[model samples]
Target chain A: MSARPAAIATLLDLPKPYLLFLGDTREPGYAKTAFGLRDWAPELCIGEFALTEDTVSTGLKRLSPAAAYAQGARAVVIGVANYGGVILPSWLDSLVEALASGLDIISGMHSPLSSVPALREAADRHGRRLIDVRKPPASIPVATGARRTGRRLLTVGTDCALGKKYTALSLTREFAARGVDAEFRATGQTGILIAGRGIPMDAVVADFEAGAAELLSPDAAADHWDIIEGQGSLFHPAFAAVSLGLLHGSQPDIVVVCHQPGRTTMSGLPDYPVPSLEDTIDMTLRLGRRTNPSIRCAGISLNTAHLDEAERRQAFDIAERSLGLPAADPMRPGAALDALVDSCLRAN
Target chain B: MSARPAAIATLLDLPKPYLLFLGDTREPGYAKTAFGLRDWAPELCIGEFALTEDTVSTGLKRLSPAAAYAQGARAVVIGVANYGGVILPSWLDSLVEALASGLDIISGMHSPLSSVPALREAADRHGRRLIDVRKPPASIPVATGARRTGRRLLTVGTDCALGKKYTALSLTREFAARGVDAEFRATGQTGILIAGRGIPMDAVVADFEAGAAELLSPDAAADHWDIIEGQGSLFHPAFAAVSLGLLHGSQPDIVVVCHQPGRTTMSGLPDYPVPSLEDTIDMTLRLGRRTNPSIRCAGISLNTAHLDEAERRQAFDIAERSLGLPAADPMRPGAALDALVDSCLRAN
Candidate 1:
């Protein structure tokens, strides 16, 4: 990571006190960025903006670009990760208005803000910066497979957009609460925006994916824990490479398999069915052993948000009973989460 | 692959015939590009050039830039793939002289020829194109895991820089000789230079690795066989991601495991040992089944260049007996190679 000076300089340099932009998406999954910032870094978020009234909300105050600027927001962050990460033409006027209102625009999309001529012209005329967190570092060395010191807990999933990030973030917090040195390592756009610095795993060149992952979580104290947020899934045909690279490079001592009980099909891919929890844990442990021979599954983090309280309880009960591992939802903090964290910390 | 017009335009459009430039290196392994061209596309190669007189020879007639141009060579291709695919500073003068002598420069190096000021200036002055075949296609889709209609036989290996490409090329030739509809799909710089068209697997964005692989060998006739040249090894910590991605995307029904018997360590990675042939085949088949459920190993392609006639025979015998698969050196064509090809074609 140190080899990339340009990426390092901008890694944690995004303008704060932000206005979140939920770009006309009704699907709450796409607006995970907005909700993530609201939940993780509430102090930095001044307000939220959206194209339509029916769009998903972060439960924050709604403010126009001018109003957000007047309220002391320094930047307007696009808080939506739509399919293909494209900047739609319908959202261009609002982004331009944000620039004219004296706020810079920050994005996590694969398509750069500069690619849109209107946004680029507006930013240029207003002298506002356009930041893209999805851009990878300029230089990344190939992973040497050389082991690094420190304990790491990575959250892998049966499919993409599950609870990997949330699980990692919660575990890191719980570790710190128990007087352990812990760092949350981000590997995607939302996680990077929340953590302020991280390698965009998906954006890196295929050869450098593992190298970038290695740089993302470097060596630290023996007792320190690097809780890494995983990306994609081993069963995910489109992104298995990214997931495998992150898994090998992170070299996690403990892994938490994230799953949503009733996910019949993979996210965004209706053709492929979600793999079973047994297969997920088995594959994760088997592939993970390549880098960390002692790698073990700590537990399962169920995304039971769509289920009722009774269903959530049944899901946890079934998972723990079948896998012989702790099962919990990070969003519902209690003895379950504590047990999951305990199992992770007890591993080493 | 068709979505990337720029890459498609330059895919098989290199100026020919080529004058192979072996930059000062005496290692035959580093000069694979030269040897590959001389062996596979001898008609397209006019002669070989090198900075040092003692450098490894492709056995083609030696020629200077002017001499090569006079003999109807249209381009000077950098025929060496050194550590990191770097263009050495010492080789700049010879490349400049080639451009000055009215020959375009075709490079397969990771470092783009346009990156060097001197080479760029020389090419610009001489109006010669600096084509980098290692550059990936512009637009690649994510792999959908939906099976394409065709038969595929991929050449994987126990380690990098073995005989994956050579085995693949030989198999394609053998299949065609048998009156089968077959094609050689290249994935690396050397293979691309030899095949004249390919997606640079390592150069692709990590998220799109499988996508690029899918595009490279798109749906063909049901009986058509794509002999894909594999990249890194699954046991290779630095490159396992690329290997896995290619495996999943290619979705091959048959795989030929390539290995060098005496190699103790991974290519350029001294810390890691090369996995045994059994482990290599086992892991490859296990992971490859994710996309192609009927995936099976056809044989092992042994790189027995370092061994004498008796040693080579012993190595092949040991490999075949131990793994229960045909083992042969593609360089030493015989019944062994024919058996390997027969096994691959019979897999459908």
Candidate 2:
């Protein structure tokens, strides 16, 4: 009864590993999810707040001012922290303002600068701190393990809560089961994931400015583009927002999309889908145009668990012949993608 | 800035579905997950206020009374209308005490009970008007479509948000694609989801007593057991609690569970997955034992898109061999089940 996560303490312990939720429901869901998180890590109360204007500014300030105030807190307001991301300056601006107003903001952005231009401006304007999400794309981290012996290619998911982490974890397990050199690299928020090798530690969102810079990378190290996966559907706004942010941020070489089954589709409204191979290729091309006109989308991939081998092959064929891009399975993305990444990595 | 949900409403209007949760964080993730239920239906602003002995009773009263007074004295406090099973009395006692303290009490239960023995006792002890939440399970009323025609099986997941609904929807789609008859029935909270059925009567949970009765036997023509799908996970106390209540209140033929994937891993602690298949079959069998020690579980089902085919086949095979029962895929439980239900209906 006494050991509780109080509002005051939670707020004071701001700037912890947190999540920036966009939709109102997702924010509350985080609260609901706290029980499980707490069970996993009692010290973790990962703060939950809506990513609305006032929440970003005032509510967050009241909830968790900053790590600076973590000591003076009367009670723990939240269990932990996690900053959700869209890789946009406008969004990061609000988060930074929240942080500037005293709430440490952190996230996994491909290219922080590419997404949020003003974040850098904000960090400079008011002495606000930033966190590096991860190192540059070309040098994606290689988890020290039976490392990929060859052109090690890794991928990640789009968001924090989405099944991306699990996807990466599973992919790693699957890879290990097959005596293949591989590792997992987390990327983006709930609906996004990135699994790669050789990413530097600094890339893990050192601060908001760096995250902003990484998100808005103009050249978007496509060569270093860490192949990322998404947690929610391809249609989730966070997915779209952050996915596009990664596109503009790293301009990935080959985008591998992971889709889990069991999504709601009551209305035609956003039942965000796991990216179809075709859809992934299409988005790659589309995003390539939007992020950089000169960049051509290399290829796409899908989870392929829901489909049978025949259906899975058909999906890949559709991606290859129709979409004119290579496709791979999440469990085991074959040689096609490896060759492409090699070609891209080797090309001038 | 004004677009923030909380900023727009004075915690009273709570433009979002704000649920001021007041309970122990250890109350199993079920109680907490109700907050996430707000996500599946995004129109509401869901808020949570975790509690202990202090807040669950007195502290909770303070918020509701204050909120009611501020908002012109209209308050709707929701809790398990009747926890029923073996642990029913004390819960009713606590609920009654809270109800007596002055404020409209909403019996937010999704079951039909014969009678709340404890409520009747508490009502006698302290005269109070009880309010019941009448919101229909949103899935009902709308025309979902026709059931897929199929002979294959479906494996229900462990709980909510994990992927049961997705499995249901996708399995239905998968069945249709393969020319099979399939439908998803989400039985929990709203009672049942007869997806795509012409008799599209949405699941609307009425009074616990009423809900119990209907669920036990929808009509004079109903039976003691019918193929049922329970939403949320077995671990979720609220769901488990309610399901237990319903099991005793109105036991169904067989209960199929649905669950989603965990957002993250429990870092230090070890997670022993319930062998997916074995745990589910055992649980279902245990449920059967309640009615009759001799009554055995017919089968087990799983609902997850994350596992690859190899994993799925392994999972299915495990269920068949260990559980020593057939696989039950909610997606396409064929005519045998239908015949059993028909026979039950005829007998009733």
Candidates' lDDT values, in order?
0.87, 0.35
B151 Cα displacement, candidate 2 (Å): 48
Candidate 1 A-chain TM-score: 0.83
The segments of candidate 2 whose C-alpha lies over 4 angstroms from its true place after superposition are: A1-185, A188-239, A257-280, A333-348, B1-348
Measured over the true interface residues after superposition, the C-alpha RMSD of each candidate is 5.6, 24.6
Q: Going through the candidates in order, what is the number of backbone clashes in each?
A: 0, 156
* Candidate 1 residue-wise lDDT, A126-167, digit = tens: 999988987876768888788999988899999999889988
Instruction: Write down the lDDT that model 2 would get.
Output: 0.35
Task: List fnat per candidate, in order.
Answer: 0.65, 0.00
Worst 10 contiguous positions by lDDT, candidate 2 chain B: B7-16
List-wise, what DockQ does each model earn? 0.47, 0.01
Q: Write the per-residue lDDT of candidate 2 for residues A236-258, one digit (tens) a residue.
A: 32222223333333433334444
Q: Report the Cα lDDT for residue A198, model 2.
A: 23
Docking class of 2: incorrect
